[model samples]
Target: MNRLDNPILQVLESYKAAVWAKDVNALVALYDRDAVVFDMWGTWSYNGIASWRAMVEGWFGSLGTERVIVDFSEARTIVAADLAVVHAFATYKAVDADGLELRAMDNRLTMTLRQQADGWNIVHQHTSSPIEAGTAQVIFRR
Candidate 1:
């Protein structure tokens, strides 16, 4: 991919594609060996290849096989020579485990990536749902 194409953005898009396909192996491949993923499930705040794979496995049962359509906005990638930070709004479509179309969720996601010998790999990712509109006050629930 062209560096001008925004490496971090590219990786984020690839991740969405992989998740949509429920291809766990491909999903894990996008992360560095020492990456961290934080989402609704709480702080998977520290993770690596093994934990990443395990997290993917955990989501396997929740797989709905529904096509995911992502609407991304407010995307900004701050790039250096070998490091970058990405932030964006993602609106997603997918069926829930109950087989009902999930209420569309607008999430704000931030990621940190490193350009390693193997190419751009995510070193950290944090995601949270939108509160109202463009606010970051996450309302966590069980």
Candidate 2:
């Protein structure tokens, strides 16, 4: 079956929607209360939902008059009973209030989720980009 057809992957859709709208509450709702996140920017790690929410708030707040569009490609998922792991190439495009694209970046994203009473909730999330071998600068695009 296609990965998109799987119910467990629905969180990804919610994630994209939340980010595009800069809806911090909806985005944080996709994670477990005890979720842990290793974001690609700024901090090294976020230990729980409270910490993750703060990061999300700051990210959306920093956008100002710009909005971010998030897209996921080359997504793959493995499901084993009540646990699932998903990895994908994620692209983020920044657009102005008028919808003109300003900048974009791509990164690798991996999320581990657990099937809960409500639905799949991410327990852990990690996002990263490759580094230049010599300069140690991040490679935003493949």
Candidate 3:
């Protein structure tokens, strides 16, 4: 494994650990100093390390005994000279404080990583729900 590989895996593994451990500081550690995180459901964009740190803090506060289990699959990594992209499919199941299942959703995630002086940190991320296979080929009704 290359030095870059360690951090790449660490960042992703940290994400999984953070969800399970509900550790906000651990999650923030995976991001770059100027990273930006955007969720499809919200207009709020978390920018900069501090802002992203705060965002994770909020999630930790809100969890309130809720737990998340992430099933990650089909992970493929592409490495360039100094950057890498990891593409994977994921299913997340959230259970509330009472251990009742809240929701289960599937999405595809692309994490773009860059090598920095400190380590390999996620610079950008894009995630989208699985699209229907034939949805793109719309046929107008006669």
Highest lDDT model number: 2
Model 3, 47-127: lDDT tens digits are 788877776777778777788876667777887877998887767778887768887777778888898888778888776
TM-score of each: 0.76, 0.96, 0.77
Error of 2 at 63 (Å): 0.9
Model 1 bad stretches (over 4 Å): 1-4, 96-101, 130-142
The models' CA-based lDDT, in order, is 0.75, 0.92, 0.73
For model 2, the superposed segments whose C-alpha errors exceed 4 Å read 2-4
For candidate 1, write residues 8-121 as lDDT tens digits: 777877877787778888889998988888876655465778887887877765654555555667888888999988888877767655556665667778888899998899
Least accurate 10 contiguous residues by lDDT in model 1:
133-142
> Model 1, 64: alpha-carbon shift in Å?
4.0
For candidate 3, what's the RMSD? 5.9
Q: Point out the worst 10-residue segment of candidate 2 by lDDT.
A: 1-10
lDDT of 2: 0.92
* Colliding pairs, model 2: none
The TM-score measured for candidate 2 stands at 0.96
- Per-residue lDDT of candidate 2, residues 37-99 (tens digit): 999887999999999999999999999999999888988899999999999999999999899
RMSD of model 2 against the true structure: 1.1
